[model samples]
Target: MKDRYTDFKEDPRFKIANREALIGCGVAVINFIWWFGFAYGLGSKPVDTYTYIFGLPAWFFYSCIVGTVVIIGVVILMVKKGFKDIPLNHEGGDDL
Candidate 1:
């Protein structure tokens, strides 16, 4: 059976918004996994045995610096390509 809010759910704006939100969440999850994997997986080693890259520990460089760069690039790409600029007005009738 059709729900009362079916029309609202099927609207293109909602679809666009849902897609954008999903994209954002997906990126966040990917970034988190990347950072956690490097920070813990590689960083678990003894400090004396740690590898260096550009004068920083390999895990620190990858997890903190590279992860930051990757997430920023993803966000910029999403904003330029994936996100939409939807209007804020539902209607004058719905205004307070």
Candidate 2:
């Protein structure tokens, strides 16, 4: 039998990290908005537990959940796109 898939990119591609980072950035934005709203819209009061990164509220809780889901979804999508090792050759080895 032959392996169904191979490594994505010759070595491990940065796609996974890139996707996770992208997702984290996005989540950060959302968190910023959420905190900004709470801070400015609701009141200029900052939460005691969390501190600001650059004078902005740190929405840690929300970021964790949303970031994880977003990153996993992105990685799964890349995998579905045949991002894994290239199609195997008939000679029983993966084609470069």
TM agreement with the true structure for every prediction: 0.81, 0.34
Candidate 1: residue 80 Cα off by (Å): 1.0
Give per-residue CA lDDT, model 2, range 1-96, as digits (tens): 236565333333455556656766765676566555544553444567556555554454335444456556655764666344532355446666
Q: List candidate 1 stretches off by more than 4 Å.
A: 1-4, 7-10, 91-96
Candidate lDDT scores, in order, read 0.89, 0.53
Q: What is the lDDT, from 0 to 100, of the residue 46 in candidate 1?
A: 94
Report the CA-based lDDT of candidate 1 relative to the real structure.
0.89
lDDT of 2 at 62: 35
Report residue 86 deviation for candidate 1 (angstroms): 2.6
Candidate 1 lDDT score at position 6: 79
Q: What local lDDT score does residue 45 receive in model 1, on the 0 to 100 scale?
A: 97
